[model samples]
Target: MKKTMFAVLAGMLAMGAAQAQTLSTNAADTAPHFYMGTGIGVVKDSVSGDRDRTWKIFGGYEFDQNWGLEAGYSHLGKTGFYVPGTTDYTAAHIKSSSVYAAAKYKYALSERTSVYGKLGLSHGEYRYSSSAPGWNFKESNNGVYAAVGVDAKLTERVSLYAEYERNGKRAWNGPENRIFGAGVKFGF
Candidate 1:
């Protein structure tokens, strides 16, 4: 977690320093400006395919052609983990949530459409303890995500898009969350 934040901050500082020398309000610097957006979303846990909704928020600076930084939180719900033997172990109604920080690079396909790739650290959350009956596990773990999606500029300062995200489980989670969501971002 600390390393991820450090990277983000360092990257942002580098970008800022670089831009300071070339940025201009005129056509010479007609490059893209920084913008931020946030919205709500839903996450579907692999276990039982249950869905937990959450407030999704992300913000970063968009520059030149297509480059930016974003981070957000995703609230997830309980998922069932069914073990085959040992009295058919069941990982209770465990509540889960995720927090992620990513850096994205976009490729513009048109004036309003673009595709992006993002990589970063994923933090997962759960409520559990050894003494708890029918449930014993780590409360959190670091994960990874690979997503592909399209973004459309809704207005000069706003945009909308949907992304399909997949994550891998570090331990046991049937599978990570398979999520699809649409959100709108308004630039400031």
Candidate 2:
């Protein structure tokens, strides 16, 4: 009986030591790091039912477990409008892009997952050009930008994220561009 009890206690101690080693080796650090990612999404104009492809490339520094800052540029895509009564021919095209920065706040949901929100200011330039000669227009707007997203860690220095972001209006009372996208981030 004494030998049996000693064996059982020894086994339990060994198992506990192994478990602790596993967790320590796999745990993510809260140290600051830099990361970058690119994503593609659709920019939809609600009234026009126009779905256009938009893409962005962004990079940032994560300060700790819950805060970061990032800046990015987006190619907001182009939308071609037909003449008022005709769908067979194109009349004008509007293209836009933006540059912005934001502060990110993250909340960890688990060892490998988190949700984050960002609020920022954006400046966008929109250009309208007509098929007809000498009919071109340009405008720009500065407004509020916001986003919410979930991130899942894939490895020690990699993650995948899906987000819904609003790029705000192109002008006062102009159409707002909303985007839904997913992408991967690499940390360094």
Candidate 3:
């Protein structure tokens, strides 16, 4: 009877330990590491269109089942002529750089794949270049962004992802800029 009781107690202890949860990106080889991405955007007005590209590089820390934190840098720029056959136009070659902190939620579709969404705030500077002589404009602002992404873990420490985000850049003219991008991530 004593031997049987000892065996039952051992089984209970093992079950208790098994029921305890363990979480960490490192625990799953099919976990995300880092990401880099960009977006193609078009800004339009009654007389002109400003087309440009925006990009970002970010890293995430997976603390548990459905939550993470992300931080990254992004930039968007555009330059060209507008209002064809007109000299009285502005050249809004605007470039912006910002750092953002975001909270993420993800759903796993498979051992190697997952889709996630994030929302965050960023502070950045805008450098606006104009075609008019001595007419450069510069300022800074705080903005918010929402993004969606999918990641494929290729290894225990590496993952690749494609993501898109809205970058709000309002030009002096009548055009506004947005951003999108895709890139790889590495985690420790």
Candidate 3 segments exceeding 4 Å error: 1-26, 29-51, 80-92, 131-134, 168-177
For candidate 2, the per-residue lDDT at 118 reads 94
The C-alpha RMSD of each candidate to the native structure, in angstroms, is 11.0, 13.1, 15.3
Residue pairs that clash (backbone atoms under 3 angstroms), model 2:
none
State which candidate, 1 or 2, has the greater TM-score.
2
Sorted on TM-score, highest at the top, how do the candidates line up? 2, 1, 3
lDDT string for model 1 (93-154, tens) is 55666777777888855444566787777887776433335456656687786666666654
Model 3, span 1-188: residue lDDT tens = 33543453344334333432332344654354444333332223322454445556666677665788888776554444443344777554556666688898988655556678988887667676666765577777677867776665655456556555654444444324344445567766
The local lDDT score (0 to 100) that residue 89 gets in candidate 3 is 72
Q: Give per-residue CA lDDT, model 2, range 23-79, as digits (tens).
A: 433434488989999987667754376666788999999998899998888888876
Ranking 1 against 3 by lDDT, winner = 1
lDDT of 2 at 29: 43
Give the true-structure RMSD of model 3. 15.3
**TM-score per candidate, in order?**
0.66, 0.77, 0.64
Candidate-wise lDDT, in order: 0.59, 0.73, 0.57
In candidate 3, list every pair of residues with a backbone clash: 34-185, 34-186, 36-183, 37-181, 37-182, 38-180, 38-181, 38-182, 39-180, 39-181
Cα misplacement distance, residue 103 of candidate 2 (Å): 0.3
- The C-alpha local distance difference test score for the whole of candidate 1 amounts to 0.59
